[model samples]
Target: MSFFSVKGLSKHFGGLVANNSIDLDVEKGEIRGVIGPNGAGKTTFFNVVSGFYTPTSGTVEFKGKVISGLHSSKIAKLGAVRTFQRAALFPEFTVLENVIIARHLNADTSLLNAIFRHNTKAEAGNLARSKEIIEFLGLKDEQDNLALNLSHGHQRVLGVAMALATEPELLMLDEPVAGMNSSEKAVMVGLIKKIRDTWGITVLLVEHDMKTVMSLCDKITVLDFGEKLAEGLPEEIINNDKVIEAYLGADDIVA
Candidate 1:
C-alpha cells in the first residue's frame, strides 16, 4: 500500500460537483505534485485530505488507516498535516511562539500541571522538540520577530514551519510558492527538497508554477474541472496532448 491513498474520491455542493471520482497515491518520502488550470479541484482535494470537507463518496487511507470523515484536528494528529494557500499565522505572536504552539498538538501535559507549576517530562521534551524545529526551519535568527513584522517570504516560511512542527508523515502544501518572486521560489524549492530528504516525509503539493512542479516532483497528477486528466512522470505529463489541451485550449491543440 502507498503511504497515502485516495480511491474514488468525490465532493459535491448542492448541484455543483467540485470533485469527481479521483484516485491518487503518494509513496513514502516522495514529492508528488498536482497541477491543472484554475478550478481544477486541486484545493478541493487538499480539503478532503485535510478534513475540511468529508468526501460525498470515497475513502482516504493514510498509513493504512481510514481518515475519510475525521475532524481536521483528528486528522492532523494522525500524522497528516497541510498548510493553506495564504499564510496563516498569529500576527501578534513571535515566530518562535507560533512554531511552539503547533507542537502543542501532541503535548501530553495537562493544563493543571502548567497552572500548578508542576514539572512534567512531556513538557520538557516538547520544548526541546520545538527548539529543534525552530533551527530546522532556519528561523533561529528571527525567532523573536513578530509574525506581522516579517517579510512576506519569511511569513510564508513561518507558516510552513508551523505545519512541520506537527511532525507529520504526510505533508500537504497548497501552493507554497504562489506569490513568491523567482528568487524566493528558488529558495522554497530547495527547502522543500531538504524537508523530504532529511525528514523522510511524503509531500503532496498543489502548485501553479509548471516549471518548478516539473522539476521537483517525482510524479505529477493533472486535474481538469474537478476530474482526473492525466497522471505520469514530469516528462510524460509535459508532453501529454490532453494536458496541453486542458491548459491551453482544444482549438489551440487542433491548430
Candidate 2:
C-alpha cells in the first residue's frame, strides 16, 4: 500500500461539491505536489486529508490505517501534520519560544508534572529540539527575535519549523513559498528538499507557484473543478493539454 492514500474522496457544502471522487497515492519519502486554478478544491482536498474537514464520502489512509473522519488533533498525533498558507505564530513570542510551545504537542508533561517542576527534563529536551529545528530552517540568527520582527519570508520559514517541532512523519505544506521573493522561494525549496532528504519526511504540497512545484515534486497531481484532472511527472503535467488549458497557462509552462 502507498504510505498515504486517498480513495474516492468527496466533500460537499450544501449544493456545491467541492471535491468529487478524488484518489491519490503518495509513496514513502516522496515529495508530491497538488496544483490547480483558484477554487479548484486543492485546499479542500488538503483539509479533508489532514482531518481539518471530514470527507463527505471516502477514506484516507496513512500507513494503512484509516484516518478519514478522525479529528485533526488525532490525525496529527498519528504523525501527519499540516501547515497553513498563512504563517501561524505567536507574534509576541521569540522564534525559539514559538517552536518550543509547538513542541508541547509531542511533549509528555502533565499538569501535575508542570505544577511541581517535574517536567524540567521534558522541557529541556523540547528546547533542544526547537533549537535544532530553527537551525535546520536557517533561522538560528532570528531565534531570539520576536516572530513579528522577522521578515515575511522568515515568518513563513518559522511556521515550517514550528510544524517540524511536532516530529511529524508526513508533513503537508500548503503554499510553503507563498508571498516569497525569488531568493526566499529558493531558500524554502531547498529547506523542503532537506526536510524530505535529510529528515525522511514524506511531503504533500499544495502550491500555486508552478516553478517551485515542478522543481520540487517527484510527482504532480492536477485538479480542476474539484476532481483529478491529471497526474504525472512534472514534465508530463506541464505538457498535458487539459492541464495546460485548465490551469497552467500556455505561457506559464517553462520549456
Candidate 3:
C-alpha cells in the first residue's frame, strides 16, 4: 500500500461540489505536489486529507489505517500535520517559544507531572528539539525575535518549524513558498528538501507556483474544477494537453 492514500474523496456544500471523487497516492519519503487554478478544490482536498474537513464521501488512509472523518487534532496525533497558506504563529511570542509550544502536541505531559515540575526533562527535550528545528530552517538568528518582528518570509519559515515540532510522519504544506521573492522561495525549497532527506518525512504540498512545484516534487497531481485533471512526473504534467487547456492564460503553469 502507498504511505498515504485517498480514495473517492469528495466534499460538497449544498449544490456546490468542491471536490468530486478524487484519488491520490503518495509513497513514503517522497515529495508530492498538488496544483490547480483558483477555486479548483486543491485546498479543499488538503483540508479533507489533513482532517480539517470530513469528506462528504470516501476515505483517507495513512500507513494502512483509515483516517477519514477524523478530527484535525486526532489526525495530527496520528502523525499527519498541515501548515496553512497564511503563516499561523503566536505573533507576540519569540520564535523559540512558538515552536516550544507546538512541541507540546507530542510532549504528553500529565497535569500532575506539570504541577510537581516532574516534566522538566520533557521541557528540556522540547527546547532542544525546537532549537534544532529553528536552525534546520535557517532561523537560528531569529530565534529570540518576536514572531511579529520577523520578515514575511521568516514568518512562513517559522510556521514550517512549528509543524516540524509536531514530529509528524507526513507533513502537508499549503503554499509554503507563496508571497516571497526569488531568494526566499529558493530557501524554502531547499529547506523542504532537507526536511524530507534529513528527517525521512513524507511531504505533500499544495502550491500554485509552477516552477517551485516542478522543481521540488517527485510527482505532481493536477486538479481542475474540483476533479482530478492529471497526475504524473513534472515533465509529463507540464506537457499534458488537458492541463494546458484547463489552466491556459489563467495560471502560470506553462511558464
Candidate 4:
C-alpha cells in the first residue's frame, strides 16, 4: 500500500461542490506537484489532508491508518504537517524562537513535569534540537533576528523550517516560492531537494511556477475547475495535447 492515500475524496459548501471524488496516492519519499489556475481546489485538497477541513466524504489513509475526520492536532500528531502560503511565524518572536515553538509539538516534556522541575533533560534536548533545526534551515546567522525583520525569502524559509520541526513524514507546502526573486527561488529549489534527499520525507507541493514544478516533482497532477484533468510525469504532462489545451486557451497548432 502507498504510504498515503486519498480515495473518493470530496467536499461541498451549500450548492457548490469544491471537490468531487478525487483519488490521490503519495508513495514514500516522492515529490508530487499539484498545479492549476485559481479555484482549482488544490489548496482545498491540501486543507483536507492537513485536517483544516474534514472531507464531506471519503477516506484518507496515512501509514496504513485511517485519518479522515480527525482533529487538526490529532492529525498532526500522526506526522502529517503543512505550511501555508503566507508565513505563519510570529512576527514579534525571534526566528530561532519561532522554530523552537514549532518543535514543541513533539516535545516529550509535560507541563506537570515542568512544574516539578523534572523536565531539565527534555528542556536541554529541545534547545539542542532547535539549534540544529535553525542551522539546517540556513537561519543560523539570523537566529537572533525577529521573524518580521528577515527578508521575505528568509521568512518563507523559516516557515518551512518550522514545519520541518514538526518532524512530519508527509510535508505539504503551498506556493513556497510565490513572490520570490530568481535567486530566492533557486535557494528554495535547492532546499526542497535537500529536504527530500537528506531526510527522506514525502512532499506535496501546490505551485504555479511551472518550470520549478516540472523540474522538482516526480509526478504532477493537473486540476481545472476543481476537477482532475491530467496526471503524469512532467515530460508527459508537458507534451499531452489535452493538458496543453487545458492551459493554453485554444490550440493554435492547426491554425
Estimate the lDDT of model 4: 0.85
Residue lDDT tens for model 4, 165-240: 8788999999999888989888998999989999999999999887789779999988777778899999998888
Clashing pairs in 2: none
Q: Write the per-residue lDDT of candidate 1 for residues 171-207, one digit (tens) a residue.
A: 8999988878888788788888989999998999999
| Clash pairs for candidate 4 | none
Residue 197 C-alpha lDDT in model 1: 93
Model 1 has an lDDT value of 0.86
Worst 10 residues of 2 by lDDT: 108-117
Q: Over 4 Å off in model 2, which ranges?
A: 110-119, 250-255
**Relative to the unseen true structure, what is the Cα RMSD of model 2?**
2.4
Q: After superposition, how far is residue 209 of candidate 1 from its true place, in Å?
A: 0.8
Model 1 lDDT at residue 45: 93
Cα-based lDDT for every prediction: 0.86, 0.90, 0.90, 0.85
Q: Rank the candidates by lDDT, best first.
A: 2, 3, 1, 4
Per-residue lDDT tens digits for candidate 2, residues 133-167, read: 99999999999999999999999999999899889
